[model samples]
Target: MAQFKPGERVEVSSNDRGFRGSWYAGTVVRREAKNTNRYVVEYDQLYEDGSGEKLLQETLDWIQLRPPPPPPEKKKVQFKFGDEVEAFYSDGWWEGAITGEHSGGKFAVFLQRL
Candidate 1:
């Protein structure tokens, strides 16, 4: 009965049994106009059965936004030879380990991290 915006996280209400026992945490992927407004959400939660691992395009009305949890404590990681870390690149976040070094010591390219 509430409006959901694209990319907003939402949970499937308990009454929505179609997706009740499966993955519920999802992001609103699209909105549709059926007799009533419907949302096509991309389910992000993993289910025990591997068969249900596809992006679920579920209706919007059945989903409700779950309040975001508090942010986790920030842990600063010192780059080391085999330390796993994520590198911020122009494209996106790349998971890797410290492999090579650069001039200032602050820059290092992760190798075989993912």
Candidate 2:
């Protein structure tokens, strides 16, 4: 069984009839009092209503839980000024050109909306 500490974030595997193979984000609240292999987890987004007003908490076995994957590493792509690129705007990706370069692999992109 995997060991998880309290307050640690983890993903809980679904054991529901139709939701098998799904994993939900949650935090480990504590281990079960009588069962060392079980833990009490507070889900991040699992709710009891359609409005998501009530959060769901449950005791899950350690076998049904796993640590969340590590964050993705940032990659730097060199681009020259005036190089054409696609920038993600408020809601969607838009075509743009690199106007300037900044520290930490950041770039100033100018998107001209038609």
Q: The CA-based lDDT of model 1 is what?
A: 0.55
Query: What is residue 41's positional error in candidate 2, in angstroms?
Result: 0.6
- lDDT leader: 2
Candidate 2, backbone clash total = 0
- Which digits, one per residue and each the tens of the lDDT, describe model 2 over residues 38-61? 999988877867797887899999
Residue range 39-112, candidate 1, lDDT tens digits: 77766654445586665465545444453344656985456677766564432234466776677667576433
Query: Residue 93 error for model 2, in Å?
Result: 23
TM-score of each: 0.40, 0.61
